[model samples]
Target: MDAHHPWNMIPLPDHTDLNLAEIDVFTIDGIFSTPRLDNESELGYSDHHENDLSTPVPSPVPTDTSTTKETWAETTMAPPPLNRRPKARTLRNEDWAPVKDRVLELRKDKRKRLREVKEMILTEFGFEATERQYKWKIDQWNAGKNVRRNEMKAIVRKGQIRTVAEPDKRSLTFELRGEVVPKEKIDRFMKREQVPFDAIYSPSSGAETPADGILDCWTPATRFSVGRTPTPSLSGEALATNEHSFFVHNISSSPALSSITTLATSRPFEGRSPRLLHSPLAVPSSLEPNDVRLRRQLSNLEQSFGEGSEPTLGTLLELCNFLLVHGRYSSAETTARKQLAACRSLYGDGHERTGMTLSMLGQVLMLQGHYEDALGVYQKAGVILKQTSGPKSEPYLRNRIEEGVLFRCLTRDEEALEILRRAEATAQQVFGRTHDVATYAQLRLILPLVELGQFLEVEERAKELKLFYSTVTPTSQSRRIIWDVNHSLGCVLLRTGRLKEAEEIFKSIWRDAVEISGPEHPASLSYLHNIAETLMLCGRFEEAFGKTDTCISSRISVLGLNHPDTQASMRLKDRILARQRMVSRVSHGDIVQSGDVM
Candidate 1:
C-alpha cells in the first residue's frame, strides 16, 4: 500500500457530489504515509515506494480549463501519458558566481552562531574566555585560511610545508589531543578542549570498616546497601488508594535490598516492583498524526495511562522518546526539559539520555523560533553527548543537524555551512556516504546553496540526495527525501524557467506520491497541486482542470472534507479553478460545491 508507488494510483471514493455533509471520511491505514511533520517531507508513510518509476506515470494538473501535459516531458523530448510507462541539467561552477558572495555571507553567519554555541557551552561548563581570546583565535585561523597560492609557492620553495590534498585542504585535521596536557586540554574546553576532572584519588584499596560508610572513591565501584525506594506490596496494595500507590511507583528508584550483595552478587527485588498505574497520554512531539504503528501505539497508550502497570527506565525512556517526537511543539519543549531535569536528577550530569532529552527540547524550541534557548541546549547536548558517544553518536549527530538548521534560520550562512559541512563529513564517516542519514545531511548543505541560488552547487548536492531515492535502495529515508526535496527543487526550476524540467519533476512526484502515500495523503495532494499549477503555467488548460477535479475528489474521500488537509486541498483546488476560468471561458460541466467557492 505504498502511496507513492507509480503503479498504485489510489482510486478516490465514489462521492457523487462535492458537498461536505454527504462526504463520509473514515480512517484507512496505509492510505498514505503521514507526511513527515518536518517541512522537508510530504504527507506519506515512509515505506511507500516513491521512486518506483516504472509504475504508471501521472500527468501534471492543469491550472486553466484546458488539456493536461504529458508527465515528465523535460527529460525526454517525447512526453509520457499519465497512465503510460515513461522514463526520464547543467550549470557550470562559475555560473554559481553570482550567488557566491551571499553564500559566503550565509556561511559566515552560520559560523557566528556556532561561535555563540561554543561560548555558551564554555560558560555552562566554566570554560571562561576574554575578548582577547576571540581576536587571537580568529586572527590566527583566518591568517592560515587566507594564505595565497603564491605565498604557498614561496613557502614550498622554503620547504616549510608539504603538498596539500584537496579534500583536507579546507578542513582542520589533527591528532586526537594525543596527550591530555593541562595547558592543551583544560577545564575551559568551551574555549579549548579540556579534561573534565583533576587527578583521581581513592581510599585504601580494601573493604570498608563497619564504622565507615560504603561510599569511597578509592573503591573501583560503589557498593549497594539496604536502601531502596520501596514499592507497595501488591497483596495489600489494592486497599491503598491510587494516589498512595502512585506515589510508591513514582518514587521507586531508591533501591533497598533485604538480601543484597555489591556488584558481584546482584538479585531481583523481593517481589515484582509494581503494576503500571497508567501509560503516557501525550503523543510524540514531532511525528504527524498518521505515523502508522507509532500513532496506533500512542492511542493504545492513552487508555493505559493512569491504569497500566509500572514500566522500567528503558520503557519510560522509550515512551518519553515517542512523546518527544509527537507532542505539540511547545508542549514537546516543556516535557523534554522536564524529562531531562528528571533524568539529570536520577542519573547525574554526565548521562547521555539527560543530554538527549535536553537536545530534543532544544529542537522543539528552535522550531518554535526560540533561537537563544536552542543554542544553549545544543551546546549542553553537544558537550555532554561527546563524552560517551564521541562526536558521532545519533544524539550528537541530531543535535548538530539542529544546530545547522538553527543557524540557517538566523541567516548565519557561514556557521550553517561550517557546521553542516562538518556534520556531513562526520555523517559520511559515521554512516556510509549513500546512507539515509548522510544524504539528509547533504541536503542540509544544499538548502543553503539553493537559497544562495548557487544552482551548480545545488545540483551537485541534490544529486547525492536524489541518488538515494532514484535507485533501488528506496529506503523510507530516501523516499522521503525524494518526495520533499524534488518538490522543493521544482519550485526553483519553475522560477528559473527550466519549465520543461520543472514540469517533469512535479508530475513525477505527484504521480509517485499518489502511488506511495495514496491520493489522499497530504504530500500527494501537495504534489498534485504543484503539478496542476505547473501545467497552468505552461498553458495546459483542460488537463489542469481535470487534475484539480481529481485532487478535490481524492481529498474529500480520503481526508474527510472537514479535516485541515481537506481544507488545504480545497484552497489549492480553488486556485486551479480560478486559473481555469481565466484561461478558458467554457463552463466545463460545473462540479459545484454547496454554494461554496470552487
Candidate 2:
C-alpha cells in the first residue's frame, strides 16, 4: 500500500496474450492509456484450472492520490501527430517504479501468452466493451487516444491527475434498454468458455458458451456474473485475479467496507453456480430507520456491493431484497443461516459485517416465529458483539430484547419478564428513559406481558406509554409501537370488565390512526374487535350487534374468511345472537338505534 506505487489507471489486464473476444471491457474514466505487459514466466500455462483466488491480495494504496499509473493498451497506438505537436515526454514516478517492479515480479508467466493473458485480464477488468462481431467497433476500441483527455492530464489540479467521466461509456443504458447483451446469450457464451479445473489460468472461472466454448470469466461475487463493466461487489477493487496470475492495480474499493465477503464456492457441488440464501418478508424491527444516517450508511454498504462495486452487486442486492420481502425470520432455521455462515467465513468471525449480517438474519428468524431459532441466532450475534462493546452493549441489549420476546411467546413468562426488565433498565441508563431507545425496549417488554396475560402490568405499562407517546414526537416505528401498546391496553380493559373505557379508546384510535397507518393494520383491527366484545359484555344488544357487524365486515376484508380474526368475528356474532335472545325476553319492543346492527 505504498503511496508512490505504480497504479493501474485502466481496469484491463497487464499481460499481453489474452484473446480480445473472450474478454469484455468498458472505459476507465474515458481516458485510455496503453498498458505495458510483464514478461512471460518460465512455467507452462495451465488452462481450465481454478486459480486459488484465495491467494492473498496485496493491500491497496490510496487510489485517488497516486500518479504514474499504467496506461491502457489503446494508448500504445498513437495517431498521426496533430499539427506535428512537439514530442511529449512521459512522466513516471521514481518511487512507484518499485511497486510496478514488484507487480512484474509477481506476474511471472509464460511470455508466449503474455499479450493474450494481459488482454484477457483487461477485458475482465472492463478496459474495453464486449468485443463485437463487426470489425468497425473493434477498431475504435483499439484506438483509445483522445485529444481532450491528453489536454486535461497536462493541467496539474491539486497535485492529482484529473480524469474525466466518460459520458459515452453508458453501459447500463444499452443493458437496461434491452438493446445490448441478453442473459441467455451470455449464459450460452459463458458455458462454452468454461475451462476445466486443471486448465484455469487465473483465479477466474470459465463459463461454457455455445458460441465461444469455455470462456474465461472473473465473476465478482458467487451468485452474480458480469462479462465486463465492473460489478458493484468488485467495483472498488483495482486488483483482480485472472486464473493463476495475481495482478494488483488500483480501483475504487467500497467506502463502507467493514470487510469483504468471500465467494463461498466451496460447496460439495463446487462446479455449479453458487446459490444465495433465501430471505423472508416482514423485516425485523431492529433495522428500522431510527438513525437515517446509519440507515444510509448501511444502504451504501448494500450499494457498495451493488452493480458498480466489486464482487457482484446482484448477490448482495438479492439478499437485501429478500430480507425486505420476508419479515424478520429465524435465520438459524432458514436460508439466513447459510448467509451468516458464508459472511463470517469471508470477513472473519470478528468483523463488523459479521455482526450486521447476523443481526439482519437473526431478525429474519425472529419474524418467522421460530423462537428457538431466533434465540440461537441472537446468541451467535452476542459472541461477535461482545468483542466490541463487551456484554453490556446497546447492541447486546437489543438482542436480549428479541430473546425476551421469543421467551414470552414460548410462555416462559418469568424468564421473559426478567430478561426484558434488565434490558429496560440498561437501555434507560445508557440512552435515557425519555429516548426512543427506552420506548422501544418498553414496547418489546409490553408485548411479552400481553402474551403472559398480565392485565395489571399491561394497564400500568399502557399509562406510562401513553404519557410517553403524548410528550414525544414519534417516528413511524415509534408510532407503530405506540399504536400496538394502545391496542393491547384497550384489550386488557375489555377483558377486565372496563368495557366503556375500552370502547372510547378503541373508537378514538380507529378514527385517528386509520388513514395515518391505514385501517386494515393488525393493531387497528385488534382494538376494533375489542370494542365489539366490550359492547357485548355491557349487554347493549343493539350497539353490540352494530360493532359485531362491522367487525365481521372488517375481518372478512382485511383478513380472509378462514383467518383467526375472521373466526373471532364469527364468535362475536354468535354472542350477539345470544344477547338478542336474552333481551327479547325482557322487552317485547325495544327502540333500536338506526346505526345499531340489529
Candidate 3:
C-alpha cells in the first residue's frame, strides 16, 4: 500500500487488515458531516434493524461501491454558492434631476406638509426620502433661485441688456428686450432735464410742477440767498417779536404757520424768562451756542433749497450730528427723520447715503433710552449697509459697534458680546488694529466685557487702546474714545478693589467729559456717577455725597427723573448716606470708650 494514499491516512485496529478497495470512504466522510434530523432518524432505523435480536435482518447482495463512492466524492468536493442579501436603495443626484421641477412646484404649495412632499416624491418618482431630506432639497433650490434673481438684478443695475418680458413662473429663462441705453447718456439726459431749486422755490412756482405742493409752505426767497441773516445776540423772544412779528400778529389766519409757531413754542428753554415763554420761537437754551448756529444754518439751507434738495439734506445731517454731540437726542431724532426722508427720495432706500441716515437715526434713538425702537432701527440700518456697502465696510462695522453698544445698554450682554466680538475681529482684519474704526470697536467691547465680569481681558484691551490713543491726533471722536476707554478702566479698577486708583481715573475722565460734551451730556453724567461710586467705595463720604448729588441733579435734568441713570444716582446717594451714618456711629462709640478709659 502506498504510504501517502487516503486509505493509509485512516486509522484501523492493530490486528485488523482491510483491503483498500473495500474500505467505505463515503461512510467515513458521513461520520464527520453535519447531522440533520432526517439523516439521524434514518441512521437510527438502520442501526435498530441490524442490532435487533428477534428480527432477522435480510442480508442484501453486495454491489460494486466504487461508482457510488466516486459520485459521492465528486459531489462533496464542490463548494456551495453564497446566499447574500440585496443592497439597500440609495438616492443620487440624477434621481432627483428628473423630478426636481415637480418637487419645486409641490414646495410652493404652503398647504402641503413636508411628509406629504416626501410621500409624493416616493409615489411619483419612486425616490424614497425623509421629510427632512425633502425640506433640505427644497431649501437648496430656493437658495439657488434667490441667487439667480440677485444676479439678474445686478445685470439690470449695470445697464446691460434689458428684460422685455417677465419670466413665466414655470420658465427658467428670461427674454432679452435689447441693449439698454448707455448709463452715461442717461445721466447726461437727466442732468439736462433736472429742475433748478431756484425755479422750484420761486414765488411764481406752480402747483402743477413736478415738486407738487412740497414747496407751498416755504416762503419765496432770493434765488441764491437765505431769507434772512441769523442774529446770535437776539433772544428767542426778541427774534419772534422784532423780526418775525408777522407770524405772531397773524398766527391765527395761517394754520401751517400757527402749527410751526406751536411746535417751536412747545420746546421752550428751561431757564428762560417767564415773559419770553410766550414767544413762538423759544429754542431750548440747553443747545450749545455752536449748536444754535448750526441749527440756524440748517434752517437757512432748508429755506433756500427746500428740505428735499441735496444741500438742505446735507445741512440737516450735519445738524443731526451736532445735536447728537450736544446730547440733544430729541432734536437729533427729529432732524435725522427729516434727513432720512430726503435721502430716501434723493438717493433711494438702498443707497449708502440712506443707510447712513438710518444709522444716525438709530444712534439718536439709542441715546434717548428707546432701546427696542433703537434695535429695530439699527437692524434696518445694518441690513441696508450690508446690501449697499457690504458687511466689512467701515460704515457697516461702525453700525454694528453701535448696535452692540445698544445691546449693552439694554443689558443683553451675551448678544452684545457676540456682535462686538465679530465686529472687532472684522475691523482689525480689514482696517488694522490701529485704525480708528477698529479702535472704536475695541472701545465698545469694554462695557460688555465689564458686564460679563471679564476683567482681565477688558484691562488688557483697555491698555492697548490707551497706547493707541497716545499716538493719534486728538479730535472730537478721539477724545470721546479716550474718555470711554478710561471710564472702562476705572470701572475695572473699582470692581477689583483698587479704590483710590479708580477714583483718580474716574475724576480725570469726568473732567474731560464735562469739557468735551458739557456737564449735562449722558456720558458726562455717567462719568460723574462713576466718580461718586469710586469715592464712596474709598470712604471719602463728603466728596462722594457732593459728586452723587451733582450726578443726580444732572441726570434728572438730562435723562429725566424716571430714567435708570437718575434712579441709580438716587440709590448711590442712599448708600453713601448709610455709610456715613455707620462711620459716625462708630466714631461716637469710640469717643465714649476713650472717655471711660481716661
Candidate 4:
C-alpha cells in the first residue's frame, strides 16, 4: 500500500509454477533472517513441489524466444510512476518592509480610522494596502508590542517585590500600615488570582484595625484561617518579631511568580493561563474547545439576550468575537449572519454598519474554510462600504484585501494578482510606496507570482524586503519578516536545484524562527519541517530522521495528531525510516542494491 516503497515496482511472481529448487536466497549476516516456508502452501504453490524436492531438479529452459519474452514481461512489473505532485507552498516570511515603521506608528492608537491610516500608508510609503491587510499587520505588531509593554510594566510596577504568598494558604502576611488600602481593590486582585482571601487582618491585638478593615503595608496577600499558626499580637513592638520579619522577606522572595502580576494586570484567566508558558491554542493537541469557561460565557450571553429580546450590536459583536476566539467557527458564523441581518434591518443595506456586518460574516465564513462564500460576502461588503462610506474607507479596503486572499486560495492566480495590484496601487497613491500597506500588497503579490512561476519577480521582492527589514531596529515582527523573505529565497533556490544554499537558508530560518517564536510555535515547527526536507534531499538521512522526529512530536503536540501537517510529518518520518532500512539491508548484503524492499 506504500506507493513510495521500491518493491512496488517489482511485480508479484506467478505462483502457479514457482520452482523451490532454483530460488536464490541470501541471509543478512548477524542482522536479520528471512524465515523459510516449510509448507509449499504458504507460498501458494501446489504440494507437488514438496514431493519432488528430494529428486534433483533441472532448471527449465524456454523453447521459444517470443513466448519466454512474453512470460518475462508478464511476470516482471514496471515500477510505479514517480510522484509528480506539485509541492505544497512553503510558509514564506514575507515582510512589508516598505511601510513597517510608518504603519507601526499609525497603528498605535486603536481608535484610528482605517481609511485615514490606509491613506497615510499610501501617501507616506507609497505602499498600497487594504484595511484588512492593515488589520492583520496591526494584529502582528500589537502582539509583539503588547508583550513588550507588559514586560516593561511588570519591571516598573515592582509589585511582586512588595507581595508574598503563603505556601499552604493563599494569604500573604504584612505589617500594619498608617493608611488603609481599599478593600474593593484588594478583593478584585485576589479574585483574579483565584486566591481564597476573604479579608485582611492584623494578628497583633495592639495594632490599629485600620477603620476600613484593611491592613497596613499589605501587598495583596493577607492571612487566612487555612494556614499553620495564629498570628501573634502587634502590641509591644511586635514589628521586630520573627513573624513580621519573615512575612516581609517572604513577600519579596519569589522571582518565579513575577510573571503572575503581569498576567493578572492584563486579562487574567483568558487564553493562556499565567502558569503556562504559551497559549492553549499554541499548545497544539491539548485544547478542549468546549471548556467550561467558554460554555458559561455562551450560556450567559444567550440568557441575557433572551429569545424575545433582540441583541444589540455590541452584544452580538461580543458574542461573535468570543466564539471566534474559542474556535467555535459554526456558532461564530451563525452569530455573524444574525448580526448582519440585524444590521440590514436596523441600519439599512447601504449603511456603513451593514457593510461592517457583512465583513464580519465573511471573516467567520473564511475561518470555516468556506472560501467561495466568503469571497461573495466580501464582495457585497466591499460594494456597500464603497457606496456608503467611500472606496477610501477602511471597511471597503479590508474587503478588497479579503477578495484577493480568496482568489489566491482558489488558485485563481491571475485574478489574485490583478486584485492585489489594484490594492497596492491604491495604497501607493494614498499612502505612498513606503507605507506598510503598499509593502504588504507587494508581499501578497509574491504569492501569485510564485505560483505563476515568476521566480525572478519573487526573488526581487523577497530580497528587497529582506534587505529593508534588516536595516530597521530588530524586533520579533521584523525578524519574522526577514525570516519569511529568506524563506521565499530558499524556496526559489530549492526550485533552482541549489541544494547547498537552500539548506543553509533553511537552517538559518529554522534557528531564527525557534529563537523568535520558540521551538513549539507552529512557525518554528514548520521551519524545522523544512530543514528535515532539505536534509533528506541532501541524502543526510540520519540528520533528517532526527529533525523529522522532533518536528513530528512538536506538530502532534501543538497541531494535534490528526492535523494534515502532523500526518505529513509522520509520513516523512516513515520515508526516512524506510530509506534507512533499505541502506541497512544493502550494507549487510541482504539485498544486492538499494531500495530492494522485497
Across residues 1-598, which tens digit of lDDT does each residue of candidate 2 receive?
Answer: 7465444431322335555565333223344333221222223222322354232222222223222334322223322222344443442332121122112212322232334433432332212222231123212222111112212212111011111232333212112110123345433433454623222222222211211111112222422221232221221111111111111111214332222222211111001011112221234546432222222333454345542232432244354434333221111112333344445445645655565556655564444333454566666566666665566677767777777776776778889889989888988888898765577778877766776678788878888988877776766655666667877787777767777888887888776666554455434566667777777777877777887787677655534354455677788789789887878865644445433656
- Report the C-alpha lDDT of model 4 over 70-154, residue by residue, as the tens digit: 4644432322223365553332213353344334434433455778877754543344656666666655433222322222222
lDDT of 1 by residue, 38-150 (tens): 21222222222345423332222222322235333432233333343332123233232222211222222223443563354233222333434433433332211232333
- The lDDT-based order of candidates, best leading, equals 3, 4, 1, 2
Which consecutive 10 residues in model 4 have the weakest lDDT in total? Answer: 264-273
Pick the winner on TM-score between candidates 1 and 2: 2
Per-model TM-score on C-alpha atoms: 0.37, 0.40, 0.50, 0.40
Superposed Cα RMSD, model 3: 31.2
lDDT of 3: 0.59
| Backbone clash count for every predicted candidate, in the order shown | 75, 103, 0, 32
- Clash pairs detected, candidate 3: none
Among these predictions, the greatest TM-score belongs to: 3
lDDT of 4 at 136: 67
Q: State residue 241's C-alpha deviation in candidate 1, in Å.
A: 25
Stretches of candidate 2 off by over 4 Å are: 1-356, 368-376, 383-388, 447-460, 539-598
- State the C-alpha lDDT per candidate: 0.47, 0.45, 0.59, 0.54
Sort every candidate by TM-score, greatest first.
3, 4, 2, 1
Expressed as tens digits, the lDDT of each residue in 277-383 for candidate 3 is 12223335454245445555655665577645788776777767876776755446546655665666667656789778878877866766656666777777787
